[model samples]
Target: MVVAEVPKLASAAEYFFKMGVEGKRFRPTVILLMASALNVNISKPAPEGVVDMFSTELRTRLQSIAEITEMIHVASLLHDDVLDDADTRRGIGSLNLVMGNKISVLAGDFLLSRACITLASLKNTEVVSLIATAVEHLVTGETMQMSSSAEQRRSMDYYLQKTYYKTASLISNSCKSIALLTGQTAEVAMLAYEYGKNLGLAFQLIDDVLDFTGTSSSLGKGSLSDIRHGIVTAPILYAMEEFPELQSVVDRGLDNPHNVDLALEYLGKSHGIQRTRELAAKHASLASAAIDSFPENNDEDVQRSRRALIELTHRVINRTK
Candidate 1:
């Protein structure tokens, strides 16, 4: 369904959409799992004249929602690669690198328009509102990073807030949407949102750690690229806590090759990587607790789903790429 939405233009847009189709598809997978778990009691009969919980219609709608989530995520990646001037994504040449910025940006816009169309077709106002808010958060987060003041860039609180907007908002809201579609209570939906939010934070924290520790080949992109781009990620932020001298280097825009080397040296010597791992672990724990806190029900399927979600939290913290 997602691939069909992309026009068969004899241009780079088709390539961009094909590349998107080959992604890990992590966002949609999570949505499907959450939907399955939330609606575990499918054996229960619906009220007369109503669709059954496990009916073909319900499953089709859920699949459409999953596709919508993936479309939005891929659209974001397309725009991000252009903004960051990223050369590679998911181990392949970026659309901007292959097609130039104008086409890439327009392709991204095209994908977004398709996603919005799908969202409207769902005809669920609450789900539409949640996803619209996620889009707003994504833009706000990117703007915050691009336009951050010097003092604001150094603040941990500011960094985490930006992280939430950039990484967590989509997953959190999508999880809530899944719960809402199941007609779950407000409290249960919030719990689903909380779980996704913490998991996303942990995922991004690990990604930052990998930036410093993983190889370019392993990461599928240039290592130390964030600092090279004049962006200070979590490791750099924590390293500055121990080596205050690095601030001057950061303030200098890290334009000098020598300063970049010195910054990397400081980060390696400091506890930055370890501390970042600790913080990620903390969020992972919170995510697990969120799943565990879901009200205990006699449905065995629900119990299994909760356990799977908890295990996913661990995987988020421990992923290498």
Candidate 2:
């Protein structure tokens, strides 16, 4: 659905979408699972020839929601590559590197426009409002990260809020949308949102950890890229607690060749990596507990879906790449 919307005049857009075909599709998968789990008759047999119009309509809406979610994600990635001047993405050259910045940014806008069209087609004002807010949060989060003062970069609370805006907003809102489409109560939808919110936080925190600990090949990007880009992530935030002198280096913008290496050395020696992992684990636990709090049900499908969500939290923290 995402690729088909790319204009033929802009072939580069198709290439960009193709590159993302093999992505985990994590956001959409979560939406579909949540839809099934929340369905009241998920475990019951359908009435003969009745067509289960409610189930059919729900499936169609959920699928569109998934496509819209992926489109938004890919659009963000395109814009990010331009902002970061990234050369590679997903182990291949980034679109901006090959097609230039103008095309990449325009393609991102094109994808976003298509996503909005899909969102409108869903015909649910509340869902449209939710996703539109996610897009706004994405821009605000990226702008905040880019424009943050040196002192703000060092603060953990600022970092976490930025993380929520950038990473959690899309998934959390989409999870709520799924619940809403399924006609779930407001309380249940909030639970789904909470689960997605914590999961996204944990996911981004672990990605920050891997930036320090994982190899470039494993991570599919340059190792230590965050600090090199002058972005202070979770690991660096924790390391500042141990080595106060590093603040000056960060304040200097990490432009000096030696500064990055020196900062990495300090981070390696400090308990920053351990502390970051602990923080990620704390969020993962919150994510698990969110799903666990769902009302008890004898249905095996519901239990299995709940367990998958819990396991996904574990994967978010433990993934090597």
Candidate 3:
């Protein structure tokens, strides 16, 4: 990985890519798959009729993008763990817990700086802007979550918008960067962005449901952590819709176990979990539809990547962790 190219970042790189303790490299995998799916022969035919959909130069650059996206994602996780005062992640002690918040925060900043260097090396101004905007949205989303009022928390629109900023923006923009780097048209780039946006939303929505349904051991973190943090997610919001009285309990704050239990009881009685799953399913469908809109490709590699991208939506919805 290019992360190892700089000898000075060895420690942070090792932490991010720890052997036998890796989290699912979801963002990089998606970005790489999107790159392959969009590798259509736009300019000219290959010399010997072999399907060389991308030149080595372009492929290397795209790989750099994959690395950059993953770096940014891991950096965000590091910062988020500190912000949430998390104890465990990926079934192990969180970076902040293991190395202290100051070191973890500094490590996150280091990763972001390295990611910027890699991104600037790509030299694609539009792609640079797209990715930079995603970073900006990350801060915006975090602030929105931290400062949301009672009324704002209850509004479905507000929740969805914040969800997009926090979770979907990076995925959507990165996917579009993949398309743009491959010289795709504006129409094709939008399709890529739409697919990423929907897939990301579905992924996060399922995460919200899993926090309720999954055990701490299976989830690699405490169940009901969101409620304990007083962060209302889709399931809780939907429950509030069905049972208005639950809002009073939420408004009272979930800082205490009593209110958390009450909220969970109301959620269990309502169709909140089911409804949240349904919403995730809807976004998964939309993501698949976006892939369907891509131009037809006869190349085997392109076709395989396209199918995998569509299949990914289903996996994101059905995954237990």
Which candidate number has the best lDDT? 3
Order candidates by lDDT, high to low: 3, 2, 1
Worst 10 residues of 3 by lDDT: 40-49
State the lDDT at 22 in candidate 3. 43
| RMSD of model 1 against the true structure | 3.2
Model 1, which residues run further than 4 Å from truth?
A: 3-17, 20-22, 40-54
lDDT of 3: 0.87
Q: Candidate 1's residue-wise lDDT over 163-191, tens digit each?
A: 99999999999999988888889998998
Q: On residues 137-254, what C-alpha lDDT tens digit does candidate 2 reach at each position?
A: 9999999999999889999999999999999999999999988887878998899999989999999999999998889998889988888888899888888899998888788878
As a whole number from 0 to 100, the lDDT of residue 124 in candidate 1 is 96
lDDT of 3 by residue, 216-249 (tens): 9989889988899999999999999999999999
Alpha-carbon TM-score of each model against the true structure:
0.91, 0.94, 0.93
300: Cα error in model 1, Å: 3.5
Q: What C-alpha lDDT values do all the predictions have?
A: 0.82, 0.85, 0.87
* Error of model 2, residue 202, in angstroms: 0.3
Off by over 4 Å in 3: 1-9, 19-22, 40-54
